[model samples]
Target: MVKLATVPVSQVAGIGAQKVKELESFGIRSVLDLLEYFPFRYEDYRLRELSEVKDGEKVTVAGTIYSEAVYQRYGKKSRTSCRVMIDSTLVTAVWFNRPYLKDKLTPGIEIQLTGKWDMKRLQVTVSESEFPGNGGPAQSGTVQPVYSVGGTLTQKWMRKSITQALKQFGEIIEEVIPEFIMKSNHFMPRKEAIRIIHTPADTAEGKQARRRLVYEELFLFQLKLQAFRTLNRSRADGLVHGYDNEELRAFIQSLPFELTEAQKKVIAEIIRDLRQPYCMNRLLQGDVGAGKTIVAAVALFAAVKSGYQGALMVPTEILAEQHSRSLQKLFEPFGVQVGLLTGSVTAARRRDTLASLQMGLIDIIIGTHALIQEDVYYRNLGLVVTDEQHRFGVNQRSILRRKGMNPDVLTMTATPIPRTLAISAFGDMDVSTIRELPKGRKPIETYWVKHDKLERVLTFIRKEVSQGRQAYVICPLIEESDKLEYQNTLDVHAQMQHAFPDLKVGLLHGRMPSGEKDETMRLFSTGETHLLVSTTVIEVGVDVPNATLMVIYDAERFGLSQLHQLRGRVGRGAHQSYCILMADPKSEVGKERMKVMTETNDGFEIARRDLELRGPGDFFGTKQSGIPDFRLADLSVDFEVLEQARDDTAELVAQEDFWTAAPYVALRHYLQREQIFQGELMD
Candidate 1:
């Protein structure tokens, strides 16, 4: 017999050609897909008699229709009212906007209504009459599962499809979980769990079933990562860029500023990793303005001085240009050759740059996504660095990694990830964090001011402008929207113009043309613009040391991480800086978030709070990256389970050679099913 997972949904009882589109819309093409579409919520159908029900209580009532329902008209409003008898008690059932129920509510008809119960005047009233035989048996009052349905698909249809998939093919529903794990975890068998998951007798059964599935998903995910890590480490050797401590010391001494202990520690870690023959997959994390770029430049310089090439891939054109200029200034003084190549560069210049890179004439090259082009070859590329690592997916990073014979990979992110999430998401990579800011970078004074104090903030900003300093005003929205009540960039821009008419004001948002945004950013980077009104586009790359004031309107509309990033724009120079959070938040959550920003400027602390507030999904952000997606597990709420799975999987990996192990063959097959055994990701 064909297994349930192998059966197609189209071959199911009621899923015809027309209904196939809706099922496919829900990402269900096979019977296994339909079975895996777990209910988001469940409905309890415990019976309650009419006399036993209390006022303002929701319940399921069983009764027989004693009188026919009528669509009685009252002024401009209409309704259907019917008298029902329940076990010697009389009650009324009312439905609003559903007058057609009159035809269905014939006399002597038995109905089970599940809805809100209220005492209207003198009689017990229940609205939202659910017809009998819709899903579960009403007399027995069994608990019901509510599946998510979209478009023309109904919940009844989904339940029916799942029923058909399970009943006819129940014998083919084989158990994939190893028996040892199932017994040790006190989990129900797979077949029993599936049955209860779809139609549980009560909430306890459903909870147990859901727990087993969630654990299965998380354990498989951890196992896959462990297998990939073991396989990935066994690849061919990488270029060992021997470190020169004296050259590094000279470079650091020549800099105008001194490196912090945090920077020195992380840099030393990188140097140690580069000396190893195996490929290095390390993630460098830090707060904004932690001097990550300079550390990277030094690492690349080490690779270059060892007679090898280096490539740094950033996320934007302007950032690439910024890095190119900074690198040229730093490396040229020591006779090191640096080159730039981007999509917008002239053809002649790009050809010359590519030729130099291939010929090893250029020591280090920096560019955007264009650095990984099909024709862009590297000569002895020893180190690969990706800035803003979250912006690149695993495949893009892999393609860049393949430019050389497994060159050491160093990915850098300014976004601070909470420790729990860092373990769950990036456990495969070695991590180094720059936890302290460089010396002499003054802390920006942060304040949370209500909307009524706007005038005082404007006055302060004007005073700062008069002192020959620039300011950045950040808004949550680019334009007005009926749905969102946050401040708009255009409205804030207009208000700034009205307040500081003599000052050069600029407007910037993501909706504007790229050239226009670049021009506006350039104007703000220099002293040409005194007050730049913008959105979060200036969150990551804008490096203006002269900008000493950052005023964020509707500050509660953004996350703490984002507010921190916006605050980092200022306090870059010696002048005292201020970050005024102007917000009139209504919810306690919003108010608390604003308080966190004002209480501390430490990003890692704020990130921990953010993880507590938003969970793991929003912690690393929605940006596509190498982090594996979890189908049923959340790292924030399920940290205990994640840790357990990590330890258990490590034990399994240590005990067996995955390919030939008999007891764990099912797990090995599952890994292959998920394509985790494929070596493309490893090599």
Candidate 2:
């Protein structure tokens, strides 16, 4: 009858200093953390009828040992095999590389063995087994929690540790959600939900437990986002631009081609926001070939036309340079002086640029985060545009905004985030989508190829190079690692060089110095390097239109969104482009993902498919994407729950008495804690 309460792991029984240290490595340092450490999957080992077992089926079988356990050693490895008779049927139980298990598997012991049954080998090679007197298989057909433990921490040890901790400290864990909310949501009691999740009597109970926990997680996250929106909306002052100049239209007309309908719509939205009384916080999202850059340029031009300076911030120097060049070409004709600020600029050049910026000689400034330095000052700064906006956190953007008087902020991303996530992350901002590619652009011809087809792909790249075209060879890793299965950029570059020594091949990765990266990218962009091997650093904002061939090694290792972005780097011009996804065809997941990329060029459609295939947490690299990470709820699966929570929180906040509510108080505390945690993590 112990009450369940959240507490530090130190308060748990049997968790000494050494165990606590080990747990911390896995981001677990408290009872609350341990309790929230939900299982990735469950092992249903409650069934025990030998006759019910089918070939290649996973099940649990209970029987008495019928023969002596046989131990065989091969080199340093050993395996224990024994015959167990259940209901007069013989089944083999085998343990690999566990020589000590031979002594434990004594004959005539009444034990339960759980694993996949290989009928062809007449084996039930035990993945898990336990004795009756101990914490054996809980029950037949029951769902058993399976925690993600380190290689050194066995499944049995994890279960034992958590069970012991729960027994001693479960009573002290207080439920965060109120009883009223629970009832309204039809959620089970917190304690009961935890118990059922850890030791469910059946699959149905497990599903119910999961539903309750997932809902709670989604609800809380959505509520927090809604509260943030309410707070910001109340405090932030809106900026109003008086002038409606034709500068944006002039810039658009100066371009070689006309803007598409989708691009035009996005530009209109930006113009509307810019001219509004309130400050504009907007996100411009488009697919790879979508004309997002042009839309952003139009917004910057609008700010300049209003007689105010504008700043464009990018994540890397290469992208900053690219943006600077593109903007310079577009703005110079209109007498707009665009300046580039990056870490690699010479001291004299930087001084001149900064002086010009301070003197209002520069109309638009494009650079990396270096633009946010304390020494960098702007004259009449009225607007800020960020590329790959997620690269900069909230604090970074806040600092940039402090440079101006509530500047109209416009952010752009090539990755098309689903609307639900956009609302959750940027609820206070207006969103604009550029859904159409520019006219005369061709979709990249995509294909899924096996490793054996590398020769063919290389031959195709060589042909493209011979025809005066550029190509890109991308890898997931920078250097070879013993842990990861993906290919490294360096190794792939070397191999490709060996295969085609005559072609100008260059290598680029995050590990390279700023100067080297810039040089390599410049070489590729200028067509000096025919084949560029790189890492994901090229995943955003690097435009090389003539580069018609893209070869991604270990394409399976990349998320679908990222893979799409990388593919976007090509097919930007009139010529036909091809994207080759090189992967292992034998892997079902890899094959299916690559096929999805091959079949569709639509970013939104691919995003949905990616979410459906790999869930929310895995779809866009959420953990590393700098968005809020969830424990129990999946943003992809709990989309409906999120929508409901958002609506409910919005309604509650609209009420005058919201601040007096107990739930509001608890939510404020939770948000403060989350903010601190996020700060520490980012640091």
Candidate 3:
């Protein structure tokens, strides 16, 4: 059979070069692409008897023209009105600006009229007409597909082009999924499903077609993930790490606070992954300030005890420095050496750290992208931990992993993602979530206030600072913009400085140099700066325990998850922290966001709501997070199907003959041709 995927759209009867260009604008280059461009909606234009129609009902009825259609013009406007008989009931049909329709609506000619019915006048305001006697397209009694079109492409033209393509190459729309799997799931054939989706007989058939398509899309996606898992395991020379040691136990017992049950469970899961013969590919996600650092410390400690060095990579220099200090404090008593390597490190210090790392002197090293530099090398690197994993690309992670001999990887994220998103986005990685916050941690008090309450908010901030606690004043922008009315960091910094002459106000934003930003954060972290006015550069990995107040201007402009992250920067200490959302939102969505922020502090719940409001594209950003932007499957609604596909693909890949079996030959061919694995597992 011919490969439908390679068959160009130009092979269709009506698609010329110009039409092909237009179709190409929508990313539809091949027959398979055109076929998969499913309609967003369908119009039920099936004909109904006049007796079944109700007042103001949009109905399609067939009738014979009983009266001569008269065309009349009133200066600029024209109307063609006529009488039609449907089963002995006469109804007036009116068409506006259709002077040419008068010639076609001849007496005794059978016609189909679709429009809204006015029961009082016994009239139909005709929007469309089909002369059944003249062999018009059978559109009167069919559910018509409506394509999202642009650039001179009409619905009629799209339908014609698609219909031509189906006619020419419908037989070659090969079954990508194995026949056995399809039969066991009671799924329809691929060819039939494609045909039914384009031209479904009824709504039920359309739903069935959608079911098959959705499942196929998710199944293919999970297949790639499964293949990656298989490929990664096959290529790995995994090391079995010894985690049950006196040092690890002493480290845990020496902590100031007890670990949460969730944290303990996740730590156990990580240990199990470490002891496995295969490399560990795990995602450790928790809410902000959920003691993820301790869990990670446990993992790093385990790796170090196994006579191997550990590597912890973060996204920002500040986070790297922060992690280095924390890890040094935790490992200092155990005589474990922790090194910090960043772009800003002194030349001599960098050289010393490099020499130490190469000589197995550094037990655990923390840094930003500098960790993946060509000059840096680790001796016997066994475990890799990445903080804020989404900030790094797959290649970056791969580079860091390659530095070691297939070191066990544990990726951590402060963003608490919902299970559905986690499953879809990080399907290849084993996920361990820590939902519980640390014991003795106080929930941040959040409030949404209007502009009038600014004075009160400032007074509250002043009071908090007077008590020897720092506060964060967050703005949406760095500089004031004429287009946007939101507060900016510089302006707010000046205002706060003027408002409190005795207190020091430090300003920070993305536009500042790295040194300046680091210095400003240092002042805030050390309590030298009474109030820090900044943009979202401090959104992640800024741990200031003394800061008890968070004032976000124009809070509605931020997503729920972002607001939650910003709120998390505070509430780290024992004092009751507070988050002030000073927003007078204009849109309902903005208002709802503010409401959600004020209502709850659960990051997972906020993530779910954010997904619903802004969709999956903007959640973690499809491009940045490597989440596939599926055409037919919605991660929000099709989560169950996603899970089922995940399970099915896992089972299928577990079979020894999955790659070479006769049933999977077509599937493998399609996968290779599409290059859906992003070249990661292509070999």
Q: Best by TM-score, which number?
A: 3
Please give the clash total of every predicted structure, in order. 0, 19, 0
Local distance difference test values of all predictions, in order: 0.82, 0.80, 0.88
Taking the tens digit of each residue's C-alpha lDDT, what string does model 1 give over 1-683?
A: 46666678888787799888778887888888888888888877777776777777778878888997878877877788888887777777787777667798888878877777776642444544666765533434878788878888877677777888778665567776666677888888777788889999888889889888877777777788777777676655567787677987888787777889998898889998888776778889999899999999988988887778899999777788778987899988888898888877888999999898898898899988899999998988999999988777767888988898778889898888877667667767778999998777888999999989989999999999999999999999999999998889999999999998899999998788766777887888879999999988888756899999999999988888888989998998889999999999899879989989989988899988888887766666664544556656666777777777777776667665556867777778788887875665432
Error of 3 at 682 (Å): 10
Candidate 3, lDDT over the whole model: 0.88
In model 3, which residue pairs have backbone atoms overlapping below 3 Å?
none
For model 2, residues 547-661, the per-residue Cα lDDT tens digits are: 9999999888877888998998998877899999998846676777888999999998888777777775554553454356777766776778777767766776677665677
Candidate 3 is scored at a TM of: 0.88
The worst-scoring run of ten residues by lDDT in candidate 2 lies at 674-683
Sorted on TM-score, highest at the top, how do the candidates line up? 3, 1, 2
Q: How many backbone collisions does model 3 have?
A: 0
Query: Positional deviation of 115 in candidate 3, in angstroms?
Result: 6.8
Tell me how far the alpha carbon of residue 531 in candidate 2 is from the true structure, in angstroms, after superposition. 7.1
Tens digit of per-residue lDDT, candidate 3, span 201-241: 88889989998999999999889888778766775468999
